[model samples]
Target: MVEYPHPVDIKVHQKSRFLDIAFDDGSHFSLPCEYLRVYSPSAETRGHSPATAKLERGKEMVSITQIEPVGQYAIKIHFDDGHNSGLYDWRYLYNLGKHHDELWQAYLDKLKAVGYQRKDPELAPPDVDV
Candidate 1:
């Protein structure tokens, strides 16, 4: 069984799309929204098996639209893209926060190997016709 060390503070920096988590043990970490989005534990993201997990790209700008507490152990985060099924337990969140650098780099390498870009390239900027 996994246990989460209680956090002394959890601050969401909306502009940067990062979460600054401070633990009671005086450890702290800053995690990006893109990292959280790609690593979401929802079935839609992680799938039923590791072999079936779908690759998620174009989510570099994804942000948490809502964060709702689920009982006393987890948080339900709703993404801007309408995905809200992942239940991020405290322990899981803590682990992610602690191992963010390694996990994030691995994800980036996977994306690069697959030729996946984190931002959409098809959207055109609006222009006024003269």
Candidate 2:
């Protein structure tokens, strides 16, 4: 079995809308709340497979409301937008941090391809049903 580097410290910077995590392997990441929310591992977001994965939109200003530890391996992140199903495991979190740039760019590209315009949450129109 492989031993994964566990998180030694996790801090939620509410004001900045990002989570700072440090691992035992000398790795650290400052993950944006919007990024985490869009890349959530929940079935509603990731689905059962890549082909079924849903595209998350309108989350530019979303923030983390809370984070609950799931036993010894993962954490459940609660978003301010009411999404709280994803279980972010140690390895998965590490990978997200490691490949942040690429993953973020891919997400942006996907949104653009689907014709979704990202805009500031405050200036967005009220309750335009998708």
Candidate 3:
């Protein structure tokens, strides 16, 4: 069985809309609020299955308003857009951090394909990997 990574620290920089997560494995990631919001694990985004997952749009200016911890396994992030149902676990966060570049590019590509213009360029910077 695979073991999930544990986070050592989680800091939310509301001003910059950055969520910095430091894992016990010594991996640190600076995740933009937009990225996290778009990829939220909530049913609202993921739906009932992988095939039913929906692409989020027009969230370039979204910011994390609050982060509520859920037990010892995950956190429920509250967005300024009033989306507060997603639960982000340690493993998911680590994976998101590890694949930040590819995931971000994919998000951008999808946005372009769907003609969804992003308002904030800071959402997906060229040098986002950690």
> Which pairs clash in the backbone of model 3?
none
Clashes of each: 0, 0, 0
What lDDT does the true structure give each of the candidates?
0.77, 0.87, 0.87
* Residue-wise C-alpha lDDT for candidate 2, range 1-130, written one tens digit per residue: 8887899999877766778889999998988888899999999999999999999998988888889999999999999899999799999999999999999999999999999988844322122212
Per-residue error (Å), model 1, residue 125:
27
In order of TM-score, best first, we have: 3, 2, 1
Question: Which segments of model 2 are wrong by more than 4 Å?
Answer: 120-130
TM-score for each candidate, following the candidate numbering:
0.84, 0.89, 0.89
Q: Show the lowest summed lDDT stretch of 10 residues, model 3.
A: 121-130
lDDT of 1: 0.77
> Where is the poorest 10-residue window by lDDT in model 1?
121-130
lDDT of 3 by residue, 36-105 (tens): 9999989989889989989999888788888988899999899999999979998899999999999999
Model 1 lDDT, residue 127, Cα: 23
Rank candidates by lDDT, best first.
2, 3, 1
Predicted structure 3: lDDT: 0.87
Per-residue lDDT for 9 in model 2?
Answer: 94
The alpha-carbon lDDT assigned to residue 61 of candidate 1 equals 70
